[model samples]
Target: MSEIMENPKGGCVLAGINSVLSAIHRTCPVYHSGPGCCMQTTAADQGQSGHKHSCFVSGVSIPSSNMLEKEVVFGGVNKLRTTIQGAVDIIDADAYFVLTGCTAGIIGDDIVSVTNEFKTKGVPVYAIETPGFAGDSSLGYEAIWNTFIDQVIEPSEEKDDKLVNIFGIVPYHDPFWSGTLEEIDRILSKLGLKVNTFFTKKQGIETIKNSSKAALNIIINPWLFKGPAKKFENKFNVPSIRFPGLFIGATDTSEFVREVGKALNLDSELVEKVIREEEEYVYNYLAQAIGVVSWKRFAVVADANNAVAFTRYLANDYSFTPVLVIISEPIYRQEDKERIIKRIENLEYANPPKILFLSDQYEINEAIRNEEKEITLLVGSSNDREVALEKDIQFINGAFPVNERLIFNRTYAGYKGSLTFTEDIYDNL
Candidate 1:
């Protein structure tokens, strides 16, 4: 199968093309750090929003890289003013986001105060303390969403329509995401309601501020978007439903659609039509690509929810017995924990995959050495891909490189994504 080989850890946090396009399209209450951080500017020259900071955002400009050592040492309150003011003067952003990098975090600079200072100017500014050392881009996404909800969004007394907010999508150019959004849009449309896919693709600031108007929220990945989902529920009384990545031809979509449908009291006929059509399209596609194999042995190493969903689906649908399952990122949310545990308990064989809670390369190597079964599928990062290659094993890099254009970036999200997934791994088969 198609496997990722190498990846650089830091750059612009949101690197996916689709993810960036989503952010630009929405013109949402979002900003990127300088090209230094994960928010690299790559918008085509179409309009002001598509220019630099406001380049893709029409009338918004993210802060510049003018905050120097003196300002960093004395605390960047004044320097922040210069940057924010300059951006404000140039871009007509609804609000400003003061994001932190590794240096800002190490210095313990008061981003909150800097944000308050900007707010004193009667401009809406929020502080997002996403240090590079702290976590990945997913964490940064959560920080951005949370800061927006907690600091900028005003609690409205009037209840609006029954729309649902779909938060936490970072529209990186993973081809799978396009199809995933299309499938989700179709399902939501069948419910006679529209969704606000903020900051992922075609999402913007107005869409984010109007989150209070949404009746419910659907979080695709809590790891990346937990900040916004929690804020919407706590402040607006909107319940949130979380899910792992939505892979193509996933039999589990039916249950997901059913749960959301129940909440909306949507037309069952339409829901059934969408679900049936999507599922069949995927099932038929997979049937042709995936054939019976002598070794059903598989292994999954991914983020918590992704690992749980993939391993369970592989077992439930493809009859691939996962003998080794490694959840690289530990389960943080209770719901995710429960979901993983439920799948583990339901495993047909009591001798489930050798489970390991891994944090880095050392842990993964140690786990591999202790494996009792010959691994047929290694699903995780390019690091694991290397390890598998060393052992002359077949592998698929589930998540590694943040950039897709660099490496024929393929994803496993949604039904159409599954077909691409099968194609990527076909050479190995």
Candidate 2:
């Protein structure tokens, strides 16, 4: 028997796909699903993420076929085509993506064929054939990237050595994705590199279309975009470097910078100078705020990427004891879990926190409650807030499903972002 997950973080696959497509500037997603699929998917991801919604098209503003019982019984292909045409005519987007809901997928609707009809007319329409039930939001992220690799990116002889495309950071789903991408872009720009964080900086389909010209692809997650990265390299001839986790605090961020520099064979003098300046900038702020926030044994409940980053940052940089670290996402691969565990375990100052792979809210809460190690501060999503309250521990809203605060370009990553994160810790205390 399949067990029910209570308050599972993020939405279905369709929700993930919608989140990614909606994040791209001037890119619209046309849903060919049931009546409420659009709204439910929007609520599942965007609604729970720091109260930030897409300004261009999202939530109720998105175009949908709204497949009904009649359409499901017969076929939604005609309706889907009409929806795509309507979105193209009215949405003013650089590209239109047709996403299949469970209903459409179950009924075996030919969404790809319908989308191809528009494509033949030179319309920027693509079909993502993955259904909502295929997997969770993480799969949605990969599916969209795979679609881009297969359909959008073109081969180019001209390549920019200083150009790089970023992957693994899911838009809206990650809550602080925009700010994190912006921080990464700012840091890379200091090294005289052009960064393509497609979800930010008004980058749309054109950027994706020309992404093959990038010299390298940087994936910042422990285990994501594996298939797409290989496909991207094979098709575009652009190699990629994978950073194990999101870089937070000075040490990891500097390490990330140096790694990128080495990969690109950038000027060593320039790279060192940038790193030195950035470290100084972070330390200068940290020096003043010394002892402003007392360190305590903390626990983090977040996705694999954030779990690793937060665990390492708190343990190694801030010199806090991590008592428990729960990866709140369902990681299927044992290798991926091992990689994440290794990163979390190999901290500098503190003992490795007890790591658990958990997704259900009940199980997550129970694990935290039953932890033998004393946790004074909890850094987690809003879902974990009540547990923190029950434990009477200080809580920092750092992860996804962040409904407590409105986050706009506020991040806890990189040199500058680490300072902001410190301020948040202090403020909460």
Candidate 3:
């Protein structure tokens, strides 16, 4: 059987690692070091069993054990160099991303210098300073995105007309990213705008640089896109419209199209035309499917921004009252947090649901103890699996599924996206 077939759950990565087990060779390269790097970077096929299967299937190109305790205790510049050199000697990828993991981040290793050593040897090396402990996957993405932009985008003689940049919506996090991009493409084409969706599944390196000429930028997710959005605004002066994401139904989709229409200064007739056509299809289906179900009392614990936006949407748009919500991080920028809070306060659900400002899983669990199981709707990570298991409560793991969705499959971003949100609600019925 083929390697892909052998691992029905996308187990081909094991061959990538195991090929290195015997000895580092020309075919197998790309060494990942530091604690948890191996597990965290797997885009698909996660979980302990899946990762272990992958590791056994594909061994490390250069065994990380080469970096001894002395290196950990003091620092591992030499060790990192040795690892990179070994990777260079054995693997033949065009470039290597020397990712800094939790341990390396904590110890403060100068991995840039190590990568530079290889660059001096006339090899293209990219140094990624991603400290795992810092923030959510969005933050990790920003680290890589910023690095890619800095390295690749260059000054050109002149900018092309009708260029546009696509931001937000990483494939792993949002299953519907591919479809979302396509939808965006259709809308922009109608508007007669030329566009570039950087990091499109088969995107080439040149696409990143060409983004400089985009007249406008559309950011799908506000949380992660904030970094790139700011950079694009400052560098390219491209006006950006950030869609807050709709995960309920048609009214939300109409609002999204109208908002984008206004941002582009499109005529009222055109905006209404687009909105009416899309809105009718969504409303007819969703209105029937989303008849006021009794999801009154809800509990949401998610990444800070997602938790906030979802909670607000539930309360104001859907008219469902949340019993308790735990925003996973309190230290996010005030602007982001403020938007969430403002929406919560503006809702008319009598005594509004409490939004917890803490992240301790134990504390969150304790809070949920006060609510009845049938009244609760737990949304967020699969990590909450243990919490649900212990409490005999049903929960929806909104993010971090093993196989990634091609587009924003969660159905929370656009009009159709909002309609899709009813899937879980419909299922629970």
Q: Could you say which candidate leads in lDDT?
A: 2
Which candidate would rank higher by TM-score, 1 or 3?
Answer: 1
Assess candidate 3 and give its TM-score to the true structure.
0.72
Tell me the spans in candidate 3 whose CA falls farther than 4 Å from its real position.
1-32, 40-66, 70-95, 102-110, 117-122, 133-136, 156-163, 170-199, 221-228, 244-248, 287-295, 312-318, 347-352, 371-376, 385-394, 400-410
In the predicted model 2, the residue pairs found to clash are none
Q: Is candidate 2 or 3 superior in TM-score?
A: 2
Between candidates 2 and 3, the one scoring higher on lDDT is: 2
TM-score of 2: 0.98
Model 1 clashing-pair count: 39
lDDT of 2 by residue, 95-148 (tens): 888888999889899888888888899998998888988999999999999999
Q: What is candidate 3's lDDT per residue for 241-274, written digit by digit as tens?
A: 8765323344444565667667767677977877
What lDDT, from 0 to 1, does candidate 3 have?
0.54
Worst 10 residues of 1 by lDDT: 43-52
- TM-score for every candidate vs. truth? 0.77, 0.98, 0.72
What value does the lDDT take at residue 28 in candidate 3? 25
Q: Of the pair 1 and 2, which is ahead by lDDT?
A: 2
